[model samples]
Target: MMLLRYLSQIGKYFLMWKEIFNKQTKWPVMKNLIYKEIDDLIIGSLGIVAFISFFVGGVVSIQTALNLNNPLIPKYLIGFATRQSVILEFAPTFISIIMAGKMGSFITSSIGTMRVTEQIDALEVMGVNSLNYLVFPKIIALLLYPFLIGISMFLGILGGWMAAVYGGFTSSIEFINGAQMEFNPFHITYAFIKTLIFAMLLATIPSFHGYYMKGGALEVGKASTVSFVWTSVTIILINYIITHMLLGS
Candidate 1:
């Protein structure tokens, strides 16, 4: 029964996707919507992203430094480990999960409210492709998600350096050298790939909950909560799958 229910949902979701891009929106309207969404979703999220990333990076560095008590372990390893953690996993995947909370709730509640208010029905009555109008702009805006993640990576590394130097864990030169050593451009590529996938999921999953929700004001809150949980789960699962496929399990 559960499997069947999920299959039905999958089919319905695909149907939604099918309608999301059938007719192009007017260029002027779309342009304005896209810009607004970019400001709302991307630029609006910058402060929290920077705050968490910097502190988390510092914590990672501190923990790495403390764990390497052995004399044989080089001090520069603190920076190196922090770099790997921040770039490969923390900045991209974990931060995305955080966004799932903020952005997902907004998407679900807004859409769910529209659903409850019969706004969507009115759109359909008017022959408007509401999903395309509402959700596509969000998806388009999040195409810049990789850019956000890139900023996270830089701030994370900077935070690590600050913590390491201030905490007297390592010399600045040593940390810089270690971070530079054996730097692989492919890591950035992998991170961006994950960011892009997560971006799509971000735009759609919450919209799904809100769009399909069948209830009143109270239910919109419920839908938002459900959307956040499901979005987080989907992201974690996809992260694991992508990691296994790309880097081998």
Candidate 2:
């Protein structure tokens, strides 16, 4: 029933990936597309990611401080909590959900439009593997997605520090010490692992939606919305599964 439909979709998605690499588009052409996508997908999204992430981190710190009403709680706990939340969850998972809306919609609508306009058909008729030409470049471009997440992690902590100090929740010394205290590089590794997984999802899921979409402009819009929802859900579910697998006790 519904379960089978989902399972079938999953199978088809993997099969598309297999075909995507079967014989890639020419290096020169793919290289240009890859560079363009890097600009569009990675460089283009930096501003929004930085702005939202900074504020969110600050809010997390302020909330943590406010909740610790008891005098017994050390002020540095604000920094500690913010670090754990941002590095482990906020930057990697929540930010990815946001991108699933922004980038996923773009991918879906762009491809869906091409589908509607018969551009994909023309490519197929010319013996070109449209999926590979269209999607592999996006996948290659998103490999740099970890770098974006890295920036988010740094800015998030910096914003938390600023908010906590300016808001009188803690002194600069206390916050700095707390942020560096008990630091585990493994947490960063975990975050980057999740970022890489998310990058693949970002490229593929939306491409799948757009590539398989039918009909005209109206359907493209519908596909974009549907792609965003499914992409977000898939990301959250995978975040849980990967976290449990990697960090579970």
Candidate 3:
């Protein structure tokens, strides 16, 4: 029964997805909406992402330096590990999980509130495809998500470098060598791919929860929480699948 219910929900979600591109909102209106969404979703998120990436990257560096207490081990490994950790997982995957809380909750609650207040119904009555008007802009705005993740990668490496140098863990020169050593360009590609997929999940999953939620004002809050959970879980699952496919040998 539960499985059947889940299957039904999945079907409904896809139906909404299909409708998002139909009965398109006019470009003039949609242009403004898209800009608003980009400001709300992408530009609004930069400060937090940058701050977290910087500190977390530093922490990763510090931890790696502490662990390599052996004279036999090269100090450069600290930089190498920090670079790998930040690029491969921390910047792309972990930061995305964080956004699943921040952005996901906002999307869900905003939409759920609209539902509760009958604003969505009013849109339908006015002949607007609310789904397309609401969700498509978010989807389009989040196409810039990879750019955000790219900034995260750069900040993370920069943070790691600063932490290692200032903490007396390694000389800047040695750390640079390690970071530059055997660098695979593919890792960046992999991270961006994961980021792009996660971006879609972040946009859609929370919108789903908000759009379809039933009940009154209280349900909006509940829907937001649920959306965050589902969004985060989906991101982690997809991260695993993408990693397995792309990096697993």
**lDDT, candidate 2, 68-185, per-residue tens:** 9999989888889999999999999999999999889999999999999999999999999999999999999999999999999989998999999999999999998889889999
Q: Looking at model 1, report the run of 10 residues with the lowest lDDT sum.
A: 240-249
Window of ten residues with lowest summed lDDT in model 3: 229-238
lDDT score of residue 117 within candidate 1:
96
Point out where model 2 deviates above 4 Å: none
Ranking by TM-score: 3, 2, 1
lDDT of prediction 3: 0.95
For each candidate, what is the lDDT?
A: 0.93, 0.94, 0.95
Which has the higher lDDT value, candidate number 1 or candidate number 2?
2
Candidate 1 matches the true fold with a TM-score of 0.98
Model 2 steric clash pairs? none
Question: Candidate 1, residues 92-161: lDDT per residue as tens digits?
Answer: 9999999999989988998999999999999888888899988999999999999999999999999999
Q: Which lDDT value does model 3 have at 188? A: 92
